[model samples]
Target: MTSLRHNMAYLLTITILIVSVGRLGDTTGRRRLLLIGILLFTLACILCGLAPTLWTLIAARALQGLGAAIMMALTMAFVGETVPRARIGSAMGLLGTMSAIGTALGPSLGGALITGFGWPAIFLVNAPLGVLTFALAYRNLPADSSGEKTDRAGFDIAGTLLLALTLSAYALAMTIGHGRFGPLNVALLLAAAVGTGLFVFVEARTASPLIRLAAFRNPVMSASLAMNALVSTVMMATLVVAPFYLSRALGLDQALVGIVMSIGPVISTLSGVPAGRLVDRLGAPFVIIVGLAAMAAGSIALTVFPGIAGYVAAIAILTPGYQLFQAANNTTVMMDVRPQQRGVISGMLNLSRNLGLITGASVMGAVFALASAASDIAMARPEAVASGMRTTFAVAAALIAAALAIAAQTYRRRRAADPR
Candidate 1:
């Protein structure tokens, strides 16, 4: 229960702070915030390790999330700012590859550490690593952001608070939705809707809104964000459901399932740079379309076959689809916006991801539960669960198709306007 609380706290804080901290990096300096975030993350790890109570751990996790938000948002903004427009996709791809490696390694590493030294070691391990990263960043990076400083005429505190409330409510709804629907979930979901409406209303009025509404005025950027959200939904849903399908329906051992699942990340990590090269050469629209096509094909393939070979093929293909789509889409969005607004644009990208993740998990989980007639997915019959999995993949494919349509329209409009 405490572990779940900590996870929720981290997720909520991290998603909400990305915008605020990204804006701060735009105003103050990416270098300062980047180093500060790393230092704070390291210190928070130590605090988490030494904490005596569950509440203490939860609070520390929340703080750690703040640091992570600052680091993630600003780091991406920095890369977008520093890299040439032509090469930003490649740079983003490399960054994604490194992230995949770390994510893939974390669970295995944490398990080993917990067995040997305790849960504290899971966090203690970050301290030395964070120190190394901090040193490298300080020694190699410049002192100031490439973009101009944002005017501090107003800080949009109200807007930030509303945005935070909105995200928190949405996350809470998802968390509570894990069990049967009740008043609490309904209330939180209502609060989320209200908060969202209020955020848009307030942002349109505020001078220093966290996100500039004008940023989305560009068809390309807006379409890119939409694609990002849809693609992420499919990606996350597949991620959550596949293990159940593998272990239960396919009768694979946990070890074999893990290895099978690892194929996606490994393939994604390997293909990142190559996908970037394609994006640079062919342009983001072409790359994005190709990615969407690959994902759609993979979804269809899995729905039809739903066996070991099918799973492997789907992972191999869909992983690159996700990687390519993300890299190209990030490049597309950043390219359309002004350099000064890149921080917030980057934040919006991360925000879209968070929304997709939470929605995908909750929505797809509900579908699986309803279809299987079981509260716990693990307890569902293999054939029933397989049927649910097929339905889920079909939905994912439909989403990709929708995104591709939007992307195609945006591409057509852009090409017609530019005529370059």
Candidate 2:
């Protein structure tokens, strides 16, 4: 539970704080806020390194999450300001590459650090990196305009609080049961639904809403967001279900399992820049179809083929597809956003991905358990684990197909309207 909380603290904070901080960046200055966030993150790393109790560490992690929220919210937004319109896809791809590199290296690197210098080293290592990042950003990032100050309407305090509470409730609802839905989860979910309704009502009336409700009316943006969430959910199944198949069905040892699992991230890291370049050359709309098709194929492969070779092949196809989708999807949203609205839009993009991940972890895990007919997954038979993996991925394939359908419909509508 302590370990889970440590992880959840960071995610929870990011989910709740990202949009608010992103809006703040738009009102204040993205560069200025980003600098402060880097400093806060660096300081929090040290606090986590020296924490005396588990709760203290969790608290520090949450603080670190706040810093991350600010940085992530603004990073993609910065691309719009700095990068040329034609190369936005490349920039988004570069971001995806960096993120994939971190994901790929984090586990192995952390294990090595812990072996050499204990668990604290994992947190402490980021201090120097954070400082270096801050220095680079401060030296190079563009300064905010004189007109960037907040207007008389100011920040929406009520909306921010309501949204935060609502998100927190939803996150807890998804996470609290350890994949078992109970009364508390149901109640929290209900609270979240009510909170969302209230938030919408308040935003409709407020002169300066946290999120402009009208934004959802844009079919391109709306459909893109939905596709992003669906794709993300399916992508997460790779992480949740593959391990059991590898370990129980194929009988790979822990070390071998780690190595095999690294395949996706490694592919993701390598493919990101190339994928972005493809988006630039072929256009985002075309690349979206290609990416979704690849994902659907990979998901189906997981169901049809067995053993580690099949697993590797599926991941090889799937990861690059993910990279392509991410670059194209981000570019589609950020390319033409109003300069003032970039930060909030970036936050919305990240929020969709995060929510998708959370839902995937809980709901997909449940599906696997149910399909396997296992009371306790860790103790389940090898055949059961394999069965579960197949069923889960079959569901994942369906999800990708749904996303693909959405993309196809979106494009058909676009062509019909424009006829260009």
Candidate 3:
């Protein structure tokens, strides 16, 4: 429960702080914010390592997430400003590859460190890396002139808080709804509704709203956001379900399971740069179609054969699809928005992804639970859980197919209108 709290603290805060932090970066200067964030993150890691209690660790983790959110939002925004408009896709693609490599390495490295030198090693190692990143950014990153001036509308404090409440409530509702529907869950959902209403009212009046209401007006941009959310649903579900299916259903040990699980991110890493290049050359819409098809195919493959070979192959196919879709999607969103709106758009991108994660956790959990209850394998049994996995994969495949169809229609509509 303690570890869960710590992890949840990190996850929840990332979504909450990302938008405001991202917008703050845009106005305050990305470099300065990035450096401050690194400092805070490094300090928070040390605090997490030395914390005397679970609550202390959780607090530190939340701070760490804030720092991470600041950096992540700015990083994308920064890349947009640094690169040429024509090459942004390629640049973002390289960034995505590096991100994939880190994601692929983190679990394995953390496990090894924890086993060898205790858990403190995990946090301690980041200190030096953080310092190096700080140094690099200070020396090499472009100077920002926006440091002195502030947005004319000023920070919408009430709006920011309300938006955070809205996001927090939604996350809590999904999380609590996982096990059972209780008073707390209902209250959370109510809070979410009230928070959203308050946020809309606040944004309507605020000069510098956290999110511009007009951003959703573009059909392509709106669909891109929705596509990101749904695609992330598939990604998160696969990550959550595949391991259990491998370890329990296939009877693989932790080591072997980890190996199999590594396949997707590994493929993602290798494919990320190439996928980005493809996005640059082929356009995001074309690459997205290809990616969606691959993703749906992989999910269907998992449904057909949940064995070791099939599992790895499914991940391998799905990985590049994920890489392709994500890289292209980021490029598309950034390209769709104006330069000044980059930071906020990136924030929205992260928000959409995280919402998908929370949603996937709740929806997939419910689906699996219900499927397990209805399966012939018997409830509370491993086979029953595996039965749930089978059902979820099929469901995921169908969802991806629907997304594919939507993307196709949108792209076709655009092409027909433009003839380009």
Winning model by lDDT? 2
Could you give candidate 2's per-residue lDDT for residues 298-346 as a string of tens digits? 9999998888889999888888989999999999999988888888889
TM-score on alpha carbons, each prediction: 0.96, 0.98, 0.94
Model 1 spans with C-alpha error above 4 angstroms: 145-147
- Which candidate would rank higher by TM-score, 2 or 3? 2
Ranking by TM-score: 2, 1, 3
Which one wins by lDDT: 1 or 3?
Answer: 1
TM-score of 1: 0.96
Residue-level lDDT of model 3, residues 243-348, one tens digit each, is 6677667788988888888878788889989988999999888988998999998888888775788888888888888888888888888875666677778888
Best by TM-score: 2
Model 2 misses residue 180 by how many Å?
0.9
Top-down lDDT ranking: 2, 1, 3
**For model 1, how does the per-residue alpha-carbon lDDT over 107-174 read when each residue is reduced to its tens digit?**
78887899999999998899999999999999987778444554554667888899888888877887
* Comparison by lDDT, 2 against 3, better one: 2
